[model samples]
Target: MPDIVSKSRSGTLGPAPAARTPRRHTVAVLAFPGISPFHLSVPSLVFGRIGAGGAEASPYRVVICAERPGTLSTPAGFDIVVPAGLEALDGADTVVVPSWERDMPLPEPVRAALRRAHADGARIVGLCLGAWAIAASGLADGREVTTHWSAAAELARAHPAVRVRADTLWSDDGDVITSAGVAAALDCCLHLVRKDHGSRAATELARRLVLAPHRSGSQAQYIPVAVPEALDNDPLEQAMVWARTHLDDPLDLDTWARTALMSRRTFTRRFRDRTGSSPQQWLLHQRVDHARLLLESTDDTMDRIAADTGLGTAVNLRHHFHRLLGTSPAAHRMLFRHPAA
Candidate 1:
């Protein structure tokens, strides 16, 4: 079926008074039979916060629910008791399906519940193979989503209407968000915190959990190892290493090809085949990525960052950074900068 789904509606809220109680957003995590303990804990670990005084300090309330509301066995040779049934999703601000079993048929009740949640304006998240659950519900039919790279082909084959982006670590389509795999699930959930609360809040939370503050969703999810051994002589790998070191210098197709000891045409073909992008495109992305790191971790000026990254001027840096990452350099630093103090 060529699946087209309905859009979710959103409401605006007014500002609260200083002394007002914190508004708690309810998060519902769904568990099913044979679910992984790690996948099931991702959401809870991300959202639940404990205060220094041992009180619940988070602005989110997380709950676990199952279709049958009973003990479910895990592949890790343990069991978890779920106290709430599908009814737990009723008042949830967000509904998360951590992961779904491979090739398992979607239950009709679960599908209907998901559809109802979406219709009621709740955000839906599918971590890893959980995207299969969302796809089966018809909510993600025409949406661009992602899942584990190994299962991406199967997801595309099963739900041809959903655009499966296997390259990205995650995909956020407004109300519907999906992630690539296990660790990517943490990245996606942390991304959700950043989206809802703000970068500073997400950064503090990530520090508490000892996780990377932010990994851009656009980063490649599954890059193959460039070399099997340190001593292995690979021209392409050598060229890439040289390029990384020489990013502050002006580089072009000819220079890169020469570095690899190959002609321009051959270099272009091999580069595209190996990296899935043209040399020019790859170089630009690398420069911008370096710029991002400089912005986040250093006190460099725009001009300095641009010069250091081989981007020439501040104007050129802003133009390319905004074009690629949808934000200005200054703003990125403001959101992500961590002072050494």
Candidate 2:
């Protein structure tokens, strides 16, 4: 028989098939000089918040380690005392380097410690500007990485060997994981949690945090587009209001355009200009939103929920639900189903 190996949710290596030991993972987050308070807090919060609501199967032990035992100054002008030194990483299963100062080079000792941790089978994570530090250590020479969009071009210019992808929220090249700017660090950490635990655990954590569980790497970082909120005290808003009230009915673009008192072509263009999406897209979003609320608050069947949301069929609902929420209606209901309370 072929050997069966366990795998982490992120598809990383876990344990040998024959190993009977329980998995207890240790995560060591590096708190070097000039680290961002936000970056440091993100990992601490995510890991600490684990096991809060009955999730205790394989908990994480998160420790903050510094280059030396001393007080570190944060960019926010706050001082944090970190007593654990590089030796704190001794038995860590994963090592994380959060955001660091942009222009400063990582100390040689820290570089050596990082390399040693990786060689000892620890996964290395670089968040935001911390990706630069990982690249400085020379381990990410040929790896694909993403940093803050503003810094992506600079990193590429400095290190031609590293394939820099600025748009992605994060990317994992086996042992090394790199994430984009500040808030994306949260997503990256959640990604790690999902990888180590499972989708259910990660989704619960995200619900507590009130964040989307999984946004694809291809999703664009939203840039604020300056546009008028409402072009007129127009009938479009009225039609939208009507659609919300009548989601159970089939609502096509023609119906909405007719209600808006505009030609199909004009309504389509103006709707996109006003809402950044076409009429059909907006209606679909509204329907999905209603379906999600129904899924969470009712014991309605998939077919009934689909009809109630105007998605027409359970199959269509499942398709759009997976595409938008990264999970199916049934799974979502299992996680969030509740009666009106």
Candidate 3:
């Protein structure tokens, strides 16, 4: 197994799996003046049901609310009518503050409501510039938080209390979670679903939404350059494809470098440029991802899974799985295994 340390700072393991009579979790997304429509829609799209029958089948009940119940303008050149007020957050299990005007002063009423919700044990999420509101409300003071990189310096200068990381896609400090901009919001929300449900459900939901099943929050929020259009013809891509299929084989950096027709030094630099991770780190993740699929779909023993995924032994598999995913293989299977299996 790889010796990589887990970057997940999120301490809370989501609410325990549903009981015999499960209650739907309530997610309250805050809407404010000049909010982004796409930002406002992320949580709803991730946690809310689509049709009338959708709510009945889904495990979460999502509601949109603002400081006052009325029409609010968005930067998208339109207005959205919010149906609820701060009271909507009173019974919420989670409160999501999406990207908002970072310079705008946090409203006293809104700040108080957020404090009350957090006092009642609600998980508070600040997506992008929403971290400004969280910080201003004193919720994120002394906590490690993150936001869109462009505004990170400003956030730090203004708050002067919270530790800000501009590189991370998201930071989950148990009750308070913050994420980088735009697409990172989607990743954060899906992570909430995965924490609440399990990998299988989150994976299926990602498929339905046409989103990547998972992107570790530790991943760099943005890649500085675009992948070349001719990437398909690159030997690096071919090498990656080959490695995915030959995971069961004992592979090393020398073999991978040779397969890519490059020296180890050149391969290392290019691989990071292309994938934003060291070769070993990327390969470790791939092996763990494959192990997840096996755990979710099959009844194979730990040793069998370990050998098949090239982790070498059952002990190695358990150590790496728990370090990366925060759960044991058996526990994961119990949460995600096919019922028939």
Candidate 4:
């Protein structure tokens, strides 16, 4: 059964406000038996202000609830005591379903509670495999959503109506939001905070949490990694880092290959193996992402941002931005721009 079976009478619910004057919102993080500690922590750490408190008004109140009250043990063999049950979904401004086992069947009471929450005008969010649970509730029917790239195939196979986007970090369809994978949950939650409280508030919160404020949802899930775990260090790390810092420079494939100490042919193969994208394509995507940050966080002119990102001309910037993100740079900035800091 489609999880989106619960009808959300409203089109979409934006994030609740954070200003002191507005009413505080209640956020319910749904937990169930044998869930991962990571899944439970993701939402709480993201929304609970788990770290030191911030200067801005609190975003919302977070409550941890289970299908039935009492003890809930994690797959890691730890137990959590909870006082609330399905009734916690009531009066929630937002309901978050963190990752659940993809194979687990949805309970009727949980589905009904989710449906009731939706009908009552609460925003519903599915993080990672939680999307599959959301699908089981029938709320995600015909919605463009994303899950962990590794599981996207299974999700699509299980629910053909879901538009599985394997490339993005998250998907926002107004009232219903879904994220790609484990860590992308952080990215999506921060995005919701940004959307609701403004970039300034989100940035401050991210700094407190030690997270990046923005990683555009449209970006590819595969990223170049060169951490120190491998005894034989990644040959491309230094080069990739250098290239990113020099996006405004005329960095052709030949230049990147030389930086990585490989011939163009060898570099092409190795770069694709590491990042799943050709150097040129990878560079283009990075430039676009950089341009987006400038558009959202600064008031730089299009031509200035273009030159900074090495798109060379405002015309080139617009073309690339539209081709990759399906929106004009001006339009994107207009939609996402936070009040000037």
Candidate 5:
């Protein structure tokens, strides 16, 4: 058995009462065999750091716990000594499982502890490959989740009950939260903070960490194609480059087909085959992307932005912006506008 040391809650909020009362949040990170140091460090770095300038700033208490209390070697050749064991999980309001190596199996005791924590109303988080451990624990059955793209297929194949969406950065099912790859873990953690504390607290933590406070889970993980190398004779690549720069202009099937020197039907077929979306859909994505940049980087009026992006009018812009971004143009600007102050 490992020695469990319970520290009095630090920062503001203090300790909890025996009866029902609000208290400081306890976050326990499970440091298992062959865990990535980068994955293990993220929660501690984000939740452990105290915010400057506030009486209400009660930082989360982060504890690294393991099945056994001792030093464990990381995949990177470094060693970390964790003094607390699975018993420490009893006090946690949230339990985090960081990335583990591919071949490692989650120990049975750890799995039981995680299940118990969830049963007792503690939120569970699985970051990166840690999703595999959570799935193995049988806690994520019938719940939607995601992991790194490379591991998503295997996780889905291995556990048919878990709904796995490979493309998204994260998914939240109330008590159980799962995130995709490395950087996306930060997004998920901040999301939890936002849920518990509010957007202002989460945004403050993100600002202190110098990261984007929020990125939509639905954003494409990677751009569709490699930047086409300059080819002296490649007209298709040239047309693509031209279309990107001229996104503000009215671009229709006829216009693009003429530019690409093909019939409209043939152009539509070829564009779909190459880009995995119809030419019109691709153009809409480009326009939305351009509008997003403008919203973040400039204070342009909605009407001017709409005309500039070829969306025809502010109403049209708002329609597409809401459809694609899940928020209006002005709301998007408020969340992502150039930081002033």
Candidate 6:
């Protein structure tokens, strides 16, 4: 059995296989003028508000607050009247700044509130460009952080005091968490849910949202994609679908590149540019991801899973699995294996 660390890039790892929180916690999200509705909604949705759907009441108390108590317009040309003001931060256990539009100024009061919230020990999160607001708060000074990859250079330039990482889905530095872009915010918030609540709750919520339960920040932020010369005929997309269907068979760089009808060099470059990894790494990740699903959802033997996922042998499977996930396949299976029906 492999030892499980109490921490990972996803969040704090709980020792109990399916540990639940002992108490409910409050999550407060910040709303600001000119913010996109999508950014404002990701935290609320992932913290278990929107997809609760007859499930047990979520263990989180979610609140959305703004600088003032009134209507605010979003970039989508819509308006929403937030229910609370900055004072709402007083009771929050976690405060999320979902995103920050570059032109929108971080008002001093908002910055003060974020500082006070962190001083009071609330976990602070800045998804996407919201990291800018977190930086403006000055708490992240001298801390490693990240934002949308496109803005990473500018963020570093603007806040040289803060170390900016450009290539991650999210960064978990204890109290301050930041994510790369729009989709990565979902991963970040789900990570928080898993940390606070547990794997069971997070898995249930992920099932509802149709999201993968875990994606380490070590994965690249940008994946290379090729045009394939046809808008409707995406060779890379088609190759990915084909690869999934053929996971049980031998797969190699030349085979995958051939499936896309591109030279191996072009395929490798495009794969990295779009998916943030080379073809080999992507194939290995997909194999591990598939094997995990098999471990959780099926009673298949180790050899079966290894064979089905194209790892070729159990030793190879265990070696790659433990390398990527930090836990043995048998141990991971024990944690996530489905209960008898």
C-alpha RMSD values across all candidates: 10.8, 10.5, 11.8, 10.4, 9.3, 10.8
In model 2, residue pairs whose N, Cα or C atoms come closer than 3 Å (at least 3 residues apart or on different chains), thus clashing, are: none
Q: Let me know the TM-score candidate 2 reaches against the reference structure.
A: 0.63
Candidate 5 structure quality by residue, lDDT tens digits, 174-193: 78889988988988888777
lDDT of each: 0.85, 0.80, 0.85, 0.83, 0.79, 0.82
Give per-residue CA lDDT, model 6, range 84-156, as digits (tens): 9999999689999999877667899999999999999999999999999998889899998878888988999
Residue 150 lDDT in candidate 5: 78
The C-alpha stretches of model 4 lying farther than 4 A from their native spots are: 1-21, 50-57, 216-234, 322-328
| Of candidates 4 and 1, the better by TM-score | 4
What's each prediction's clash count? 0, 0, 0, 12, 0, 9
Model 4 C-alpha lDDT per residue in residues 1-341, reported as the tens digit of each score: 53333334575645544446656678899998888888788877777772245423465788888889899888797798888998989999889998888889999999999989999999999998889888888898999887888888899999988788888888888788999888899998888887676677778778888898887534352644543566346568778898889999998888789987899999998777776678888889999999988998889999999999999999999999998876899988887766733
**lDDT tens string, model 2, 1-341?**
86667787889976665747566688899997777888998888887786564435437778899998789987797899998999977778888898876788889999999999988999889999889988888889988887887888899988788999875688877699999888888899998887666666777889988888765432232434455567467676777787889889877778778888989999898776656667787778778878877886677889999999999999999999887655888887775543221
TM-score for each of the candidates: 0.75, 0.63, 0.80, 0.83, 0.66, 0.70
Candidate 2 vs candidate 4: the lDDT winner is 4
lDDT score of residue 113 within candidate 1? 87
Instruction: Tell me which of candidates 3 and 4 scores higher on lDDT.
Output: 3
Please list the residue runs of candidate 6 whose C-alpha ends up more than 4 Å from where it truly belongs after superposition: 1-23, 48-56, 103-105, 210-226, 229-235, 242-252, 255-263, 269-276, 291-341
- The residue-level lDDT of candidate 3 at 91 comes to 79
- Give candidate 5 regions above 4 Å deviation: 1-22, 53-57, 217-220, 223-225, 228-341
> Candidate 1 regions off by >4 Å?
1-18, 49-55, 216-226, 231-248, 253-279, 291-341
